[model samples]
Target: MRFTLSSSILLAILLAILAWPVAGCGPTPSAPQAAAIPLESFSGRVLTTGLEAPWELSFGPDDMLWVTEREGRRITRIDPATGEMTEAITIDEVLVDQQHQGLLGMAFDPLLLQGDDRNYVYVAYTYDATPDDGDEQDDPRAKVVRLTYSESAETLGEPVELISGVPAGSDHNGGRLKIGPDELLYYSLGEQGANQFNRYCAPIEAQRLPTLAEVEAEDWSAYKGKILRMELDGSIPADNPELGGVQSHIFSYGHRNPQGLVFGPDGALYAVEHGPNTDDEVNLIEAGGNYGWPHIAGYRDDQAYVYANWSAAPDCEQLTWTGLTDPAGIPKSVPVQTESAWEQDFVEPLKTLFTVHNSYDFEDETCGASYFICRPSVAPSSVDVYPHDGPIPGWGGSLLATTLKNGAVYRFKLSGDARGIRDVDKLFDTVNRYRDLAIGPDDRTFYIATDTSGLTRDTEGGATDQLANPGSILVFTFTGGRVKSASR
Candidate 1:
C-alpha cells in the first residue's frame, strides 16, 4: 500500500484539519505545564563506600534501609535519619563482579525476629567456585539463599539454600527478586543461553505465544525468562497455575532480562524488561500470563506472533510513535512518510522509559543483538502520574525506577479506574544520575543509587577494568511537587 505524493499530502491535510482542534487536549482539566520545577535537594552522607557494583534496596524490620553490593559481596545497613552506614556481613563463599554474576538481590521477611518465625533475608548471588582471578563465567553457579539475621551480633548468620540448581551463563542471569503482596517470593529467571523459541514454549498445542503465567510453567526442567512465585519456605504454592495436572511455580514468562520488579499500591506486579534494540517495556503483570518477547518486540498490531492466551496484548498502534524526523526536519515516527503523519507532535525523548534492552548479545557472540538499550538521562528517574488537585486526588500511587546505563530514575503515575494501563507524564528529574529508587516510609522522600564507574569523573576509568570503588547512594526529599535537595 505505497502512498502517492499528492495523495499523501491530501491525506495529511485532512488528518491535520480533524486533529487541530484537539491538539492540546488532555484527560485532566489541569494539564501538565512546560515550566521546570524548582526541585528541593538534600544530600545524605555516604553510609558505606568502598563497595563494588551495589544494587537493590529495601527496608528491614528495624526500619533501617538494607543494601546489597555485588562485587563486595556484602550486605550493608544505613540509618536514613542519621546518615550512618554499617556493614552487616559479607558472603565470602560467593563470587562478585563477574560477567552476569554477583550478590544481586535481597528481600526481608516481613515478619522478622519472631520465636519460631525468626525472620530471614533472602539473597540471590553468584555461587561460582572460581577464584578472584579473572574469567568468572567458567565457574557458572548462581543460586538463591536465605540468610538469617541474629540480633545479638548484628550480622547475617548461616545461609540456607531456599532454591538451587538455577543455571547461569555469561548473560541472561536474571537476578531481580521481590516478595509480592501475597507474601510469596516472586523472582525473574533468564533463559541462560537458550534459543529465542524457548521464550515461546507455552499453550501446549494451542500454538499461542505463552503469557507470563504460561511461560513460568514452561517446565522448570527447561525454565528461562520466566517469573516464579513460591512460599517463603521455598515450597510451590498450591494455587500456582498447573499444567497437565502438574503444579508449577511460574507466574509469567517470555521476558528477556528483566532487572527491575516492583509492586504497585493496588497489588499489581510491575516489571521493566530489556527489549530487542527497539522496544523497552514496563509490564503490568497478572497471574499465568506471558509477556510477548522474542516472538514480538513491541506491541505488534499485525499480530504476527501468537500472544499468551490470557495475556492482554499490547496496543501496537500507540507504540509506533517514535520521535524521529523527516528529511525536511519535521519530527515523525521512524521511516517518516508523508502518507501518514503523527497527529500529535513528539515532545521530548520519553523522559520515562520502562524497558531498555541493548543490541549486544553480551555473551559468546560479539554480534549486535539489535535490542535498543535505553541510555542514561541527566533528569531525575522519578515521574508522577497522580494529580495534586483533581477528581481522584492524593498520592495517585506512582511507581519509581532507575536505569543502570545512564543513571536516570523514572517515576510513572496512573490515572483512570480502568483495569488496563496507560502512559502519563515524564514529570520532574534530579540533578545527579542514579538507578533504582526506594520511596522512604515518609512517602515523599526518595533515594537513588549511582554507579561510580560510568559517571563523568576527574579520571577516565576504562570500562573493562574493574574499579575497586564504583558508586554511591543519594537521598532526596520531594515536597510540594519538587525535589528539595540531594545528599551524598
Candidate 2:
C-alpha cells in the first residue's frame, strides 16, 4: 500500500528543504584566522593540454570549467571529469594590436547563478579605431561587449556593444574583468605606460593630443589610467565617486596596467597593478581612492617616477643627469601628475613586490634608497584569495598571486586583519607564464592556466628555446598530507 500526501503536508516539506543550509555554500568568510590550519604538504597534476595562450580560468554553474584564450579569440568550456571539450565559441571581432592585446578578459553575468532562464557573458577586447581612415588612424581602442550563450546550440550570439571607444595601447591595455561584491561589473585601465615623452618631442609634434586637458579633463570617454564601476547595461553607477563631471564611472584613477583584481575571503577588494620599471604594487582598492601610478608609486616620494624606464634600458645616465636636484623633477608633462602637489591622500600599497635590482651605477646604495633600480619588472597576471577551510596547509587564510614575469605563484601569508603580510611562500614554481587560477567547489581542487611558450625574455631581449612547450591547463589536487609536489 502507498501513502498519499496532503497539499498542506507537501507545502511544509518544500519550505523546510529550502531553509536547509548547504556546505561550501554561504557568504564570504569573515575571519580567516577562524579557519586557519597548518598545511605542511601539497601536490598538483596537469589536467588538460594544448591550450593556446590561455588567459583566464573560472568555474560556472555546475562546476563547468570556462576558459578564455588570449591569442585564439575563443572561449572554451571543458568537462572537468573527463577533460573533454564541451563547447567552444570564437569571437572574431577581437583585434590583436600587439603581442599583448586581444580577447583578454571575460566574466559570467552574476545573474546567471540565480537560476535565471537566460544569462549573458561579458568580454573585453581591443577594437580597430578609425575604420574610415585608410591612410592615418590605426589606433587600437578597448571595448566591452555582452553576448548571450545558447547551451543547446553551443554558440555565442553576436555581441551587443556595452561600452566602446575606451583608449587602448599595444603594450599597456589593462584588460581584466571582475564582478564585485556589490553585484556590479568592475574593470581596470592603464595609462599605456610606454609614452616615451621626452623622445617623442612632447604631445605637440608627434602625439596628437597637444594638451593634458584631453586626458584628465573629466572625460568618461577617455579610459586612461582608471578603474570603472558600471551596471549590467554599462551605465555608470550613480553612487560612484563624484568628480564634478559626466565621467562618473571612475571608481579610482591614476593606475598603470592593473592586471589583477580579487575579492578577499574577508570581503576586501585588492588590485595588483604593474609598474613601469621598478615598483610593482598590490593595493587595497577603495572608492574615490587614487593609488598613484605615474605620479607616486609604492610610496610617497619624488624618486618613484625616476625609475620609469624607456626603450633603451640601463639608461643610468640619470645618475649623471643635470636637472635631478629639483624637487619637482618628476614627469610633469601630464596635467594630472601634478595634482594635490604630490600629497599623501593617495593610498599606499599594502606591499611592494621587488621587481628591480637594488644596485645601480656600480654599487650605488644611495640610488636604491630613493628609487628602485630596474633590473626587470614583475608582471603579475592574476590574484585570488583562498576561501576558508581550504585543503592546502596554511593556505586557508592567505592570498595567492600568480605571475608572468618569473612564471611563479607566490603566496602572501597575512598577519593583521588581512592587511599586513607575515611572509610569502612559493606554492609551486614552474617555467610557464601563469595567467589565471580558480578554486573549485571543494577545498581539495584548484586549476591554473599558463602561457607555455618556451621563449624567455632576459632584461631587454629574449631568446627562443629549441624545444617549445605548448600552453596548458593544470589541475591541482590537495591530498591533505605533507607530500612532494614535483613528484606528484
Candidate 3:
C-alpha cells in the first residue's frame, strides 16, 4: 500500500472507470421529442394595414373576416382572399379612452349561419356614463348590444341594448363576448384595473356578489370581475347558476380581466386571464365557480405573488405606487396577503403561462423603467382552441394564445382529457403586439391581428416601441415538411 503507482498507470485506471456505464445511471432510452415547428416552415405575409386599434378577429358564416376597431368605433369585414374592407357599422356611442375601451367583442348568432331569419350580431363596447347632475365626468361604462345585419345592404343597424352599465374604466375593461353552445350570451368584465397604476387607490370589488335588490334594479356594479350568462333577449338565463344565494346573469365570479373565452371541442368552456405581475392563467370555466383573484394568483403555492392592498393603506393617496415588494416608498401600512391565507374553495387554473419564485429580480436594468414587461407575464390578449383534426401535424388539441408583451403566439398542447396542458411551444415570434388570432378553415392558415402601437419585447430581449407590423393582419400558413426533433 505504501508503494505509489506511476502517473500514466493511474490515469489509465481513471479512464476505464469513466467509460464504464453503470446500470440505471446511464441515459434512459426513450422516443425522440418533437421540437417546435420551425418558423421557416411557415410562410407569413401581411393581409392588410392602416387600421386603428384592431381588437377581435372572427370568421363570419360568409367566410369573411370580422374585426372590431377599438379606436375607430367601427365593426369592419374583410375579404380574406382580396383583403377588401367593408364597414359593417360605426358605433357613434362608443366612448374610446386612452386604452382598453370602445368596440370590443363580436359574435354571430347560430341561426344567422344557418341561413335563418335571425341575422343578429352581438357586440360589446364602452360608453360615457357621466351623471346628468354632473357627479362624475368622463365616467365610462360597458354594454352589450344586438345589431341586425342586412345582407342586401351589407350593413349592421337597428341596435338593441341588451345589458349595460357593467363597471368600466380606462383599463381592465374585459369586454369579451361570446355565444356559448347553450345558445346563451356569455360576457366577461374586469375589476376595472383597481389596485394598480393610476387606480392603485381604488378598492377591488371582484369578490363582491350582487344583492337581490341590486339585481332587481339592474345595477351591474357587482358584475365587475364576472362572466355573465344571458338569453338572446338580454335577460338572465332561466337555467343560470345561483351564486351566493342569488340567481343573476353572473355565471362565474372572481375573475380579473378575462379577455379570451372559447369552447373546446370537448364542449367545455375555457377562459384566458391576465395576472398581476406573473401567472397568466388558462382556466376551464365552470358555472358558479369561484376563481381566486387577489387571494391567489396561479395556485395556492405562496410563491412570488402577494396581494398588496394599496387601497387599504391609510395614506395610500400619499404613498407613491411602486410595483415592488417592500420598495423604499411603500410603507408598512400597506396590507399584504399570501396565497395560502385564502382557505376558501375555488377552481384552479389549467395552466399558468409562467410562475416564478419570490427571489426573482424585478428591477432588471436592461428593461430600464419599463421593467414590468420584462417579467414572466406575457400579457395574454386572446386564446383559440385548435381542432382535434387540425391541418398542422402534431398541433391538434392545442390552444393558440396571442400575447401583447411577447409579440408571439404560444401553442399549449392539451392533454387527452383536455383538462390539463401537456406542453407548450412558441410560434410566429415577431416584434409586434398580437392582439388576437383567427384560424382559417384549412386550420393551417392563421390570421393574427396586431395592435396599432404598443411597447413589446424585441428580438434581442429588450423593450422597444418599434413594431414590425402595426394595425395590420398578418397571415401565417404552415407548409408540409419534416420538423426537427430533439431528445427530451
Candidate 4:
C-alpha cells in the first residue's frame, strides 16, 4: 500500500528508460529470451540461515526485515545489517504447518509510514480444528489478523482477527496477502486442496468431491478458488462486485492455488499460478474474472498430463470440481459438471512454462532433453513489481518471480500496452525451495525466504534429496556485466 512514489511518476521514469531499449528482445515464439541483466550483474549472499520454513518477508518499520516462518509458527524481526533474529512473536497455536499450509503472508499497515501510533502488521496463517488431531490437514482453517507493532518494546502486541474461516487444507491454503494502494486487503484461496490430492491419485473416490454447499458452509465468502478483497478493517467495499450484499468480500474467483499476487507498475494486478505437471502460469488478474483450474490449465482444457515418476496419466477434464457459486451464493455452474473449464469463459495466463525442470538452463543445448525440467511443475511462490532505481539494466521496471520446486528467481520484462512478455530470464538458482520474497524500501536490495524444511527434510528424515541445505534468507544486489556460464 505504501509505494515510495505515485505509480504515474514511476511510469514516467520507466518510459524514459524504455526509450533506450536493448537489442533482440522482440518476441519470438519458440525460444527463451536473453537476460536483461548481464550474467555478471547478478550476485547473491545469504543474509541469514536457520529459518525453519520461512514463508514471507517485508521491510517493516525502522527497516527491520519482518519474516513469517511457516513451520516455526512465528513472525520474526531480523536485523538485516547483522543478519540476526532480533525478536519474534510466536503464533504456533494458530499456525500449524501442513508442508504447504502454515503461518504465511505478511504486510505492514501503510499508515505506519505516515505516523507511529497505529502501525499494525497483518499476518495470515492456518490453525488446527482440534488439539492433537490425527489428520495433518485436520480440518485446519485459515485466518488473517492484525498485530499491533510497538517500536518502543520492539515487539508485536496482541492480534485482532480481521478475517476468519478461509478454506484451508494441508496443501493449497493460498496464504498470500497484499494491501493495495486503495488500502484494502487482497488475499488468495486455492481450490479446496483437491488438486494437490488428485495430482497423484488414480480412480478418484466420490468422497473427495467438494460441493458448493460444503464450500459455502465456511464463514467467509466463496473463498476457496477465489481472490478476496476487503477493507483494512474487514468490511466490504461498495465497489465490490457482490450483489445483494452477501458473500461481499470476493474480488475475483476461479483460480487454482494462486501463489503470488502483486500490483504491476501500471496499477494492474498480476498472479502466478501452478499448473498440472506442465504450463505453470503467470497471469494478469482482473476483478471478477475467472482463471480456469481443475477444468482447464494454461490456455486450453488439456486432458492428459502424466506423472513421470509413476507414469500415472490423469485427465483434468475427467477430474471433478463440484459446483461454482456466484458471489450471490447462487450456483452459476451446474452441479457436478465435468467439462473443459475453458468451456465456461476464463482468462489466460500471461506466460506459461513447460515445467520447472529447465529453470536454470546453462546454455541453449543442441538437444533440449539433456536439460531436464522438474516433473510435475515449477511452482512460483511469490511475485512483485520491482520498483527500483537500480544498477541492473532494464530491471527498474520488471517482475521479480520466485520459485518453490525449481528454486530459482526470475526476472520478466513485458512489452507494449498489453503487458505481454518480451523476455523471461533466470536470474539465479540454488538448492532450496525459494518460498517467498520482498524488496527493500530502497528497491535496489531484494530479500527471499527459502524452505529449510523442504530442502533438508529428506536428508534429516532419512530420505535422499542430496540437495539439502539450511533454509536461509538471501540478499541480492544487482550490478551489471556479461560474464558467461557461471553458477553457485
In the predicted model 2, the residue pairs found to clash are 39-393, 39-394, 41-482
Clash count, one per candidate? 43, 3, 0, 4
Clash pairs (backbone) in predicted model 4:
41-479, 357-373, 357-374, 358-373
Ranking by lDDT: 3, 4, 2, 1
Give the Å error, residue 421, model 2.
2.7
Q: Write the per-residue lDDT of candidate 3 for residues 1-488, one digit (tens) a residue.
A: 01133454334323321222111110122112235675546777788887899999999988999999999999999998878899999998898866888899988999875768899999999988875654332678889999999998989999999988877888888888899888889898889889988889999888889999999999988988898889989998888998888999999888889999888886788889998877888899999999998788877887777888899999999987887444344678999888898899989988776667667776667777778778778888988999999877788898889999867787778888998777666677677899999999889899999999989886556788988788989888888777665333
Better of 1 and 3 by TM-score: 3
Native-vs-model 2 lDDT? 0.61
Question: Candidate 4's residue-wise lDDT over 351-387, tens digit each?
Answer: 7764222232322242133222323346788898876
Distance from true position, residue 479, model 1, in Å? 4.0
Between candidates 1 and 2, the lDDT winner: 2
TM-score, structure 4 vs. true: 0.75
True-vs-predicted CA distance for residue 135, candidate 1, Å: 7.6
Give TM-scores for every candidate, taking all chains together and pairing residue i with residue i: 0.65, 0.74, 0.91, 0.75
lDDT of each: 0.51, 0.61, 0.82, 0.63
Which one is best on lDDT? 3
